[model samples]
Target: MRVLVTEPLSEAGLALLRRDFQVDVREDLTDPEALAAAIGPYDALIVRSQTRVTARVLEAGERLKVVARAGIGLDNVDVEAATRRGILVVNAPQSNIVSAAEHTIALLLAQARNIPQAHAALRAGRWERARYQGVELAGKTLGIVGLGRVGAMVAQRALAFGMRVIAHDPYVPRERAREMGVDLMPSLEALLVQSDFVSLHLPRTPQTEGLIGAHELSLMKEGARLVNTARGGIVDEEALAKAIADGHLGGAALDVFAQEPPGDSPLFHLENVVVTPHLGAATAEAQDKAGTQIAEMVRLALAGEFVPYAVNLSAGAEVPEVVRPFLGLAERLGALCTGLADGALRSIECAFLGRIAEADTRVLTLAVLKGALSPIVHEPVSFVNAPIIAAERGIAVSEVRSTVSRDYVNLVALRAETEDGEVEVAGTLVGRRERLTQVLGFELEMAPARYMVFLTYEDRPGVIGRVGTILGEHGINIATMEVAREAAGGLALMGLTVDSPVPPDVLEEVRGAVRASAIRSIVLPA
Candidate 1:
């Protein structure tokens, strides 16, 4: 076996690869074409964030069985292209947990004790003991925004410092937070209102892009401190700067930014703000762990053993091309089910029915999880950790395959059970287009759209007209509608696509007018 290393790696990792296979270190293959030309003979490739594993590059690796990322993000790699080629991509997520968690504490202590400002004042040959007086962490409240890997660690560490720890994570089970000895707030607003210090440990997703904007920052208790050791963009820089300037916030500590090497920003000039160059994962121990992890995974792939860190671990080597097209559909169904389930998720079960069931559908199961949790999670949910995240929250996941797809080439049905109720959604691919054909137990047909309305109503005279009339009355334009029912005067399901999102009050009016059994406004990006 042969392995190619396109970027600098720890000697510990290189030694491991060299022990089992021939190794080539080529740090000059920054060009995609150059990397592709040199990749044809290698069975494995390793890189950091610098290399671009494009589709053409993957195609050039004729013997490639694995692509390993020695860091956290895979932005430089084309994951979908590799999955289609039956290649495995693995990364080490655990490598940076402690580093980031420790950094969060460092920043929190710095802000609380005015360490940076005090140090700067003394360095200028001035005695300023009285001017640098700071508060103590003991008896203070530390609120964690996301209780994932880093956030969990922060809670444990903060508790040891005699700080009251409260958290807010919807996907995490209440029992889990209790086990950690942390109080989980019911909502972000609730946490903000009571916290003396707020720390963010969330990803940069559309839902979380401006999570700590003006409105959220305004909800914080007066003179409250803030810390961000997670991704940038999760907090609005402008809002944070204004809050500090207005004396509404005590101070802030930031390690990441919305843009790397950010241009002139107001946060930099604020004396109360402490910023780092995104060094959350910068530690010798972290680098060594990343290298060792990727090396072990590459070896496992070559030996045909199970590789747990693989981005497509659920995808078996025998997954057929016919079933690949429906992967997106399955994810959409899962996403839709979660959006309507209403409460903390408990379990997920997806069944593969019809001719497509002949092949293993295990790989497609992650897509369902990705869709279901992406809507609410603060991190990028991937095939690699979706199951892990589910397990951490005590959520059960199972996949069943049946050789009966009913009138279609293949059908995927997914169900998500939450604390409130169970929501089931199923869909299938028609030609190249994927459409949802079932919601709950109704046989409805509709394509996934950015804006939609899912409702159940009595099958009676004027019900359909009444729905349309109520929507029009509220100036909500219906783009399209699909309806299916059991029988005359029986219950019916209506899936409608609208020009824009249906406001809560408007949906309530429609629900009241049509006497809906249940109604939910859904948004699924097309």
Candidate 2:
């Protein structure tokens, strides 16, 4: 096997890669064509932020089996393109929590003490102690947003400094909050009003971009300070500058920005603001950890084992053999239920029945979550990270086991509770094939294929015929069909596997023709 190292990495990581493969080092390949040509022969590629794994490079590497990033973010890699090519993209999400948490606290203390401003003043040949008087973190209230790994660490550190810690994360369970020894606020507004300092530790996503804009800043206390070591773009820079300029906010400490290098921002000239060059994960320990972890994942992936940190796998469960065959079914069931679901997910319950239920099912349960959230979350969803994502969304998760089954020897049932309501899907393995056995409360068995349509409508005659006619008119062939209902003139669900995805116009036409209560297309990848 061959491995390519395209950027600076820890000696520990390089040594690990060298143990099993022929290694090449090329940190100076900045040209895309050069990178594309150079990457063709390597079986695995390892990189840090310095290298961009472009689509051209991935395409050129016909032998590439894995692309391992040394850090958490995939902004520098073309993950979608790699996924399309069936290349494993893996990262170390656990490498920098402590470093980022410590950095956030460092910035918080600096902001409270006006450390940067005072140092600058003293450097200019002035010892004005009276003019540099600053507040203390002791006896202050600290509010944390997005109580993920870093946020939880920050809470612990703040408590050690005698600061009262409160948090606002929609996804964190109240029990988890209690375990963290922090008060959880129901909303961000409530948290900001009660806090003397606010820190952000959330990933930047469509929903969280500019999360703390004008109105959000206005909700803060008059003397509150802000800290961001998470990502940029979550705080509106323009709004932050205005808030500081108008005396609405005390100050802000930033380690990241909406734009790298943050060229010509008004906040740069503000004495109350302190900034860093995004050094949250700059510590030696963090780099080494990230490098070695990513190296190990790449090694496993190259050996054809399931890498727990992979971004594109539908089934990452490493359960026993008896339970392994059902992992694909579990994942697909999760994805199907999630697509059919409405509103934000609130909870997920994984129920294992019959023989497989007696075995350990933690991995199976996580597969369900990974499958359900992969379609919706901006962050990469995997069995290793899905529980955290669900917690971040305040979604409760549980696993249930039963030794009895009506038909199959083993069955996996997935139930999702969203803001709207609950939806249940169950599946089993028939010989070597996975089969969808139940939906809602109706029971029927069918091996779900690649492309399918799911619909619920009034259980009356002519509805099925109208749907079939509409699909036929659109040139779609039904490969298999399964229908279920509780009573004669009530609601019924029909799932039909088709040769191709139905177009929007055709689906709309079918809905209109049959008066479908709900209808959508689902693709279960083989």
Candidate 3:
């Protein structure tokens, strides 16, 4: 297979790809047309932040099976367009964990110790030891936000520095944080109030944008410093600048700005502020790791094997063992409702209960969107792009967090209110050690494998046999089937596991003949 590696990736990442395919390595591909034209014959394409895999590039790469990013952000690539073409997109998430974590720590130390000011004063031939006096890190309290990979690592390093570290991450397990010797704070306000230094390691989202505004800055101890090496716009730059100018806060060191190559910001002129040109991921070690990881991901994608670090891995074709077949519960549930007889969706709500609630629920939410929107859109869908896709299609999304669930353990419900009306469907994580679950409020629980037919019909004695006969006649054999009913002759749900994908035409035929409320063809991971 031919693979195109665009942008400067590490030699290690390329070595893995080179072992299996003919490789084209280019440091730049700024011209979209030229890149598109050259990428047509390649089976896989790899890129960093510079390359743009637009619709043109996607369409041109007729044989393209995968597009891998050497870094975390998907903003550079057109992920939705790729998904529509059934092209797998992967990224190296763990490769840069250490790099980012270390950078956050470095910025924190620089701000706390006033290293930049001290160095500048020394270079200016001024003894100024008293003026540039710094504080010791030991015995100070460090507050960390968003306890993902980077946050956890930052906590570890801060603890080693003899600083008491406390963190606030709604998603992380309390036990895990305790094991790491990091105090888990109840809220952002609590962390800010108690910390001598506050650091951000959160993702960029609407909820997180400007999260550290004037109100939050006011909560910090007067002399507390702040550091941000995560995404730009995560902190209110304007608010921070005002706080510093008014002597409300001590100082700040920012490695990222709301805008890259910032467009004339006041923070640059401040003597108390230390800024870097977004160098959090600039280390040679990080670049090499990200590149190598993407290369390995592409190798697995080409070979039809599992690729970890996929932002949308749970939603995509590759399935891991822990969740097993239960992963498909969200996808199938989405498919059952997206294609069903309903009005447009005014709002979409997802509920995570029991064990599934304990795990990362973000992937589960995206999986539902993937199965629901795959048939309607023309591109590959992703977590980063899922919300965007829904917005464009005029759908509202709402997620519910609850642990008040038992027996079924984890339950996912999608409610769609279209022009026709509003309809709600729910599912849950079920089955034994191997992991199987029921989707779409169905009573049926089966191993998550490919090609299943989910049918909603009037509860009746002969409906199952009639549906079975229709499938058998169409050369579609049912591997397994289970039914759930509200009451006899009332509404019922059935999950039919099949050997092959039930073609759309065949599904329409079954829907029409059986007079069922809905019928959808679904493929899930095993």
Best by TM-score: 1
The regions of model 2 sitting more than 4 angstroms off are 30-34, 314-348, 352-363, 371-412, 416-526
Q: Give all candidates' CA lDDT scores.
A: 0.85, 0.83, 0.74
Top candidate, metric lDDT = 1
Candidate 3 is scored at a TM of 0.62
Cα-based lDDT at residue 390, candidate 3: 66
Model 2 TM-score (2 dp): 0.74
Q: Which lDDT tens digits does candidate 1 get at residues 274-345?
A: 988878878899889989988998898898876767766534343467776876787778778877876778
Please write out the lDDT profile of model 2 over residues 1-526, one tens digit for every residue. Answer: 9999887888898899889889898987756678898998899998876578999999999999888888877767887688778798888877877898899999998998888888998999989798778898989999998777678889999999999999987555566777878998988889988999999987775457889999999999997899999888999999999999999999999999998878999999888999999899889999899888988998888888878888665323234878667767887888888767754567888999999878988878877887776655434566688888777657789999999988889889888887677888898988988888887667889887767788898899888788888899889999888888878998899989999888768988998998988888876534
lDDT of 2: 0.83
Q: What are the per-residue Cα lDDT tens digits for candidate 3 across 307-401?
A: 55454464345444544445467776675566553444445677776666666576667777766665443233444456765664456776776
| Of 2 and 3, the candidate ranking higher by TM-score | 2
- CA RMSD for every model? 4.8, 6.8, 14.8
Give, for candidate 3, the lowest lDDT window spanning 10 residues. 430-439
Backbone steric clashes in candidate 1, count: 3
Model 2 residue 274 CA deviation in Å: 1.5
